[model samples]
Target: MAEHGWLFWALTSAVFAALTAIFAKVGLQGIDSDFATFIRTLVIVAALALFLSYSGKWQNPATLSVKNWGFLVLSGLATGASWLAYFKALQLGDASKVAPVDKFSLVLVALMAVIFLKERPSAQEWLGIVFVASGVLLLALRR
Candidate 1:
């Protein structure tokens, strides 16, 4: 691991992502999904700008390679789409249930990466994914 420890960043991101769902669930209580997404994005944009200013690391990209531009735009759109749908889900169900179902996308991505990307996982990783799927399934049986 690097001196800063990538695991710390990963865990921080995970916790923030979970809390984002909770906040969106509460904040979007009476708003339409589209409007909620707009509100969230605007606020996030302002926050990002402020943080960049404070950190003195803001940069203007005057040139981008075609491939890099394509990847960046596609990734940004995919992320926005996910946030939109996730907030909608959070709005409609219990936070615990909605969060688990949304998180199942992780398992879905793992499977899809194997099938489409030809990515392989270790035996233990496969077992852990299977457990994740089973637990998610069991959640549906709860009253």
Candidate 2:
């Protein structure tokens, strides 16, 4: 099971992401999306803090390499921007439509990995990416 941990976690993430769209759509009612995103961020930060503390995984940030800090900071910025945009989109659009479009990130990530990480996806994997991209286009361009 441990060897297949990534599969399990990836499925779990998808479940939670589905829930996130539903919950965020409802929660956005009568509130500014930016404030809602801030509240969500605070909750996530507190929950992760507690989880790390309970799991004894807390580490000194000062000990990390500069490269680690740099990339982590960049990743955090990207995540913040993504969350802000997602929340706003959910506020304005149908969650069913918005979430699928947001998942176009899957195709973007595969392309980025190939370009920046020099990752070589097998033909089968490329086919999957193409399918996902096509699906996203279908959802996004539909009337």
The top-ranked prediction according to TM-score is: 2
Spell out the clash pairs found in candidate 2: none
What TM-score does structure 2 among the candidates reach?
Answer: 0.97
lDDT of 1 by residue, 1-113 (tens): 58869889979988998898878878987789779999889999999999999999887675768898899999899989998888787777888887777778879999999
Which segments of model 2 are wrong by more than 4 Å?
none
Model 1: lDDT of residue 81? 94
User: How many residue pairs clash (N, CA or C atoms closer than 3 angstroms) in each of the candidate models, in the order given?
Assistant: 0, 0
Candidate 2 Cα deviation (angstroms), residue 31 = 0.7
TM-scores of the models, in the given order?
Answer: 0.86, 0.97
Per-residue alpha-carbon lDDT of model 2 for 86-127, expressed as tens digits? Answer: 999999999989999999999999999999999999999999
Q: How does model 2 fare in lDDT? A: 0.97
